[model samples]
Every structure is written in structure tokens, then in C-alpha cells.
Target: MHKVSVIIPVYNVEKYICECLESVMAQTLSTGIECILVDDRGNDASMEAARKCIAGYSGPIKFQLVVRAENGGLSAARNTGINNAKGEYVYFLDSDDIITPDCLNLLVERASEYPDAEIVCGDFQTFPQKDVHKLISLQGKNFPESSFDKSWIRSVFLSSFPVIAWNKLIRTDFIRRNNLYFREGILHEDDHWHAQAYRHVSGLAFVNKVTYLYRMRPGSITMSDGVEERRLENMTLIFSEMFAKEVEWDKPWSDWILKSVGSLRYIGNKANIKEKAEHCVSQLLPTVYKNQSAPFILRLLFKYYFHNGVIFSSRLFYKLYAIYWKYKG
Candidate 1:
């Protein structure tokens, strides 16, 4: 067994797979790391590029490739990687992204320090292809370098540290014991799995150093223009499932809703999926309003909408609020 299993889900990332794999090959703690590359039946040369890189790689880490029988999407590809991983900790890496030379070393060091932590997170930086050499810190002021238990899990959820899967090094046993798996065939699968995992984590740790480099490339699923409807539907489904759970109310709930409203408005305006976005807002408003932990302004807005139903419809209000946010930013 290895110390960490870096799972790379390969789709149509032929242009960037070599760089991603090379970063894996250049890990400081290369001896005890296993790189599992899962091919999701992509039509491009991604698999070929991976094979060439792995073939020429002289690193001490173990490398394995799993080819899917058919195209099962990102969730399925990641699930396959998780199922095949033989490491104590699992780290998901996008094929288009790269990690620092000490990424694995830093995460493993933090894990050693916090032996009870089920999840260890490191900061990340995002860059476009042209500016790949530049690094910008995504760490926020509220993110502290400390170890937290389940009691502080909600705070972790509400922190500036992203809820993204790639930024964290998760214990394999914790994920297996909790039966945590990504929802297959969905666009926003990470949100669902992370939401559940956050609730059950026994301990969490943070590494203040930036380790991962997220590439903001065009035509990626999150940045694509044509997938707005599917994205909106997936967002709604995830939030519905999350809100229906009998979890304690907290400020994070309200903050997340408020933050999501901006995305809803963007989807409505860009994708012409206003009806679906409005439906989700209608379903979530009551829950958002009921959470005392939420900001007073958000609750007040919901109350105003409730009392004056005709004057400020959910859709209209979201549109106006999004405008305010745009200008504020």
C-alpha cells in the first residue's frame, strides 16, 4: 500500500494531460505515492498522452491505468479510481490541473501531525493557460492552520477553503467506512458527496501552503456555455437533497444559499433557464428564511417577498439582487 493515491480522471484533456502527469511524476514524496489514471472513454488522445508519460516516467511512484468500458462521466471515472486505489489516503487530481512539487509531501506531513484527521486540505491557486507560471493564493482570512474535530466541521464548511474534492487529501478508510461515493451522471457531483462527507468527518486539518494549481481553461464543463440547463438542474437537485436532510441549522446554510443565488441568476440569464432556477429558489427560500444563523438581510428579503408576493417575485428579486452583487463586486 502507498501513502497516497493520486487519482486522475482522464477525459478529453489531451492538451494538458502530459503536464499534469509530469507534475505527479515530480512529487517530492514520490516513493510511496500511487498514480491511478482512469480513462473515461474519451475520443481524444488523452489516454495515449498518459501512456507515453507513464512509460517514460522514471519516478519511484507506482502508476496504473484503468480504462472504462464506456463513457460513464466524471463521477463514474472517479468512483472507479477510488475503488481501485490502494493507498491509505486518496487525493483526486483533475487531468488538466497540476500540483506543486511538495504537494503530496506537505499533505502527508499534515496528516502525520494530525493522525486523527480524516480529511486534510491544502490551499490552491488558479491560472489560465497563458499565465500558468503565475500563482494567486485562494486562501481567505478566516482559514486558520489548525486541527478541528467534528464539532468544527460546520465551520470548515463555511470557511473560505473550497469544498472542492481536488484540494483535499482524504483518508481512504474514512471514505469507505462512510460509504461516500460521487453521484454518477451529474454535473455537480462534488457538492453532494462533499456535503455528506463534511457532516460525518471525525477530524479535519488544514495546510496553509498552496499545493494545487487549478487551470481555468475554456470549454471545461464548469466554464462551458451550452451546459447551463444541466448545471442548473444538478444544482437544484443537490440543494434539495441537502436541505431535506435533518441536519442542524447554521449560518453556513444561509451563507451558501446567498452565494448560490448569484449562480442561479447567471444561469437564468445566460442559459435562458429562468423557470428551473426560479423553481429552485422558491423551494429554498423558506429554508433560508427559517435559519436564524443566516444574515439578517437575507432573512428580511425573504420576509419581504413572503408579505408582498406580487410586488417582489422570487425571480425578479434574484435578478435585482444579482445586479447588486455584480455592481458591488
Candidate 2:
């Protein structure tokens, strides 16, 4: 079996696809690696460029060009790639970005060292430009030293570790056994997938090496116009799903307190969405915070701020969470 399957979803990334593929082809640990390129039926020359790049390739790593029947979005494309992937571990590499020659090598090595790790996260650097992007994304970043449980989820909100698929190497069996597939028909699918996948991860390991190079492409979803409302809606959906699952946790407030405030911060004033969030929080608070043995000020924040028609900022949540983390019994 292949040690790693690099899944690259091809969809109108013709200009940068070749560079992305070359980075994989140049892998220092190319043996037992396969690259699966899922063509999501975009009306572009991306596949042609990928074909031309692979035509002359005499590398040990195998390549598969899997074509979809119709044009599906990024989430669907990644699902197809995961379905077709045959490696023990799978790494999603966006066609527009590139990875270091040792990307696979480092990830596989870390996974081997900690065989119980269902997810292994690697650090990254934004390429060519976007130094400011690096600062905002990397500041306060705290990586776990070894495989850990749900407590590690704290990093998602409190730290700079992001929720992007490209930087995470996921174990194939862990994903399938838990039925963790990307939610289809949505932008920012990674945000949804991040929460879903983490819900089942036994533990996550971190390899702090900079293996991936992230490129800030023009016309990306974040830069597109007329999508603010849609973005808010999708984030609300994702956060709500998380909140639902979190309420079932034995100690929901541990993560839920910070996460709930984080949710309100993003899904601000989206028509009647506040009611949905409030309802969820209302059901959770009496059962959770009243019985949850947490810090006094933290519990006070959630209990009052959630129901008193009051809203707060993520910075306040962070400030309080930082204190809670520093003095948790």
C-alpha cells in the first residue's frame, strides 16, 4: 500500500497547476507515494497542463487522473479525490499552491513515530508575498507536542493554527471509519470539514516544519465581492453544527464557551440567525454551565452574555479563555 496519497483537486488552476505538481514530483520521499488529480470538470486547461506535465514524468510515484461526470464544487471534488485515494494517509494539496520536497516525507515520518495519531498537522509559509498574512495567521500559534485528546481543540480558537485542509495530513482509515466526508455544496468547506473531522480524531500530532507554501491568489473566495452575506450564512451553519455536537460533550463549556463567543463574533446580525444561536445556547447553558465546574467569570460570561441580549467580541473571549487556561484546576 502507498504510504501517502496526495489528492490535488484540479479546477481552473491551469496557470499554477504545473508548479504544484512539480513540487510533488520532486518529493525527496517519492517511493510509495501516489498523486491523485481529480478533474472537477472545469471549463479550463488545467487538466491539459497536468497531462502535459505528467506525460514526461518518469517518477516512482504513481499518478491517477480521475475525471468527474459533471462540474462539482471544491468540496465535491475533494470528496471524489478521497474516495479514489488508495494510500494509508491522504494529503490535500490545492492546485494553486506548492509543497516542499520533504512535505510528504516529514508528515509520513511523524505519523510513523506516533502510529495512533489520526491527524498530523504541519506548519506553513505563505509564498512570494503576503508576509502580513503570515503574521496574522501564525501569531499565538501553539502546537501540541504529541498526540492529544479533545483538549487540543483549544488551539483552533485560541491559537493561529488554521482550519485549512492543505496543511493537514489525515489518516484514511480514521476518516472512513468515522464517515468524515467534506460537506458538499458549500464555500469554505474546510471550516465545516475541520470541525467534523476533529470530532472523531482520536488524537492529533503536530509537525512544526514548514512543509506547505500557501499562495494568495487573486479572485479567491475571500477576495470576491457580493459574498459577505453568504460567507456569514455558511459560517453560521458550520458553527451551529459544532455547537450542537459540543452541547453533548461531557464538559461542553471547556471549548464551547470560547467557541460559542467565537461563533457570535462571526455570525453577527445575520437576519434571524441570532435566534438560532441563542436557542442553542439557551438549551446548553442551564444544563451545561450551571453544572459545569468552570471558572466563575467564564461561566458568568456565557450565562449572562448569551441570554441578556448582549454580545461580545472574540478578543474578550480570548482574554478570558487565556486566564482560564492559565489557571484551570
Candidate 3:
């Protein structure tokens, strides 16, 4: 079996597939790595583009193109790749992103160092089309210097959102053993899957340098306006799972709720979400209260309205909130 399987879920990224494929093929490591490309029912000549992209590369790498008949969302595409992965370690890369030549080498090195660790993560750089690149670090507390524990992981996860799966190199067998997979149909599936994965993980390792380069497009889903609602719904789904299984409550749980409240406020600013946003935010508020993270003062802000009162008084609540903020400012 290959040492690492690099899975790329392709949709309509015909413009950037070439560079993405080249980056994988150009890995500095001589270690055996298989590249699995899943085409999720794209009409943008993605199939032909993929074939041409990997045509001339001859290395220890093996490549396969999986074309699904129907158009599944990103989660399903990734799950399909996960199911077909035939390597000891599984690494996920988006079709539009590029990796450094040492990306595979670094992951393999980290995994070898922490042989017992199920997941190994490295830092990545995000480059917007017209703006300078920024490094998005996932190495908050689980890096080479620190020892891993539940609390450390909880803090590390709370430091930022785990939307980019490219920084992680996960063990395939461990995933199968734990029955871990992405949540299909969720906009931010990574948050839920990674949250659950970190719970059972024995250890985590990180590389200091940038290994992956994420090219930010103007209209990417990460930059979309509709993401806030979907993200809130996904977080609600995740917290429900955590509570259902009786996972131990901790400060990070409260922190996550705080982050969700900020997200609700953000969604409240969108004109398109004016109609249903309040109900959605109301649904999310109960979970936030269940965590009891909000300060007493913040909780009092919603005191006039009962726990579920926002569901009925959503429009008025939003209007009053707007007027209050407008004058308060």
C-alpha cells in the first residue's frame, strides 16, 4: 500500500487543477503516495483537464479519477474519496489549492515521529488572487514542543475554525476503526468531523512551516454570504451530537457558543437573511444558553423574550436591535 493517499475532490475547478496536480506530482519525498481525484459531476471540462494535468508525471505516485454520475456536494465528494483511499495515511487537498514540494515529506516525518498519533497537521499559507498571502496556523498548542491531551486539543480547536482539511494528514485505519467521516450536506463539515476526531485522538503533531498554499477566489464558498446560516446550523448539529453522547463539558464548549453568537450577529446584518435569520438565530441561542457561556448581562439582553420567544418576535426583535445599535453607535 502507498504511504499516503492524497485525495482531491474536483468539481468545476478547471482553471487551477493543473497547478494542484503539479504540486502533488512534484512532492520532494520519494515515499510512495497515491493521488485519488474525485470528479463530482462537473460540466466544466474538469475530466479532460485532470487527464491532461497528470499525463506526463512518472513517479511512485498512482492516480485514479473517480467520476460520480450525480452531483454530490463537497462533503459527499470528500466522503467518496475517503471511502476509496488505499493508503496508510489519508491527506485531503482541494482541487483549487497548491502544496509545497515538501508537503508530503513533512507530513510523513511528523507521522513517523508520533507513530501513535492518528492525525498529523501542518501550517498552511492562504494566498488571495490579488492580495498578499497569509499563514493560517493550526499549530496552536499541539505542535512539536507540547504534549497532547484532551484539554490541549480543546484549546487548540477553539483557537480557530477547522475549515481547511488540507493541513491535516489522517490515518486511514484509525478513521475506519472509529467510524469517522465528514458530515454530508453540511456547509462546514470539517468543524464537526475534526471536533469528533480530536476527542478520540491520542496525539497530534505539527510542522512549523507553510506546506499548503490556498488560493482564495473571489466567489469561493468561504467568501459567500449564505455561509453564516449554514455554519450555524452545522454547529448546532455538532453540539447536539456532542451532548447526545455525553461528552464532558469544558470551557471550550462555552467558547464555541460565544463564537456562534458572534456568527448570529453577523448573519443578522445580511439583508437577504432578514426573513428567516431570526428563527435560525433563535434555534441556535438555546444551545448557546445550554452551554451557559454568555455573561449574565448578555443573557439579560434576551430576558424580555423567553428562551424560544425569538421564534415568534423575530422581526420585532431584529428591528429593535437595529434601532438600538444605530442610536448606541
TM-score of each: 0.82, 0.77, 0.80
**Local error of candidate 1 at residue 57 (angstroms):** 1.7
lDDT of 2 by residue, 131-249 (tens): 54543243346656564656655445323456678867789998788888899877778777766665566677778778889888666666576665566657656655565564434
lDDT of 3 by residue, 1-329 (tens): 88898999998888889989999989998767999999899879877888987888878789998877788878888888889999999999998998999998988998888777777777776786544233246544335432467667667565453445676888999888988888787776776776677567776677777788888886677777567667656656665565445555576755555555545444554535534545555454444344333353154346534443343355656654554444343
Q: Scored by CA lDDT, what does every candidate get?
A: 0.77, 0.72, 0.71
lDDT by residue (91-187, candidate 1, tens digit) is 9999999999999999999899888888888887777554322222344445455556445667656445466888688999988998999989889
Q: Which residue pairs clash within candidate 3?
A: none
RMSD, every candidate, angstroms: 6.4, 7.0, 6.3
**Ranking, lDDT, top scorer first:** 1, 2, 3
List, in order, the clash count of every candidate structure. 0, 0, 0
Candidate 1 segments exceeding 4 Å error: 129-138, 254-266, 269-273, 283-329
| TM-score sort, best first | 1, 3, 2
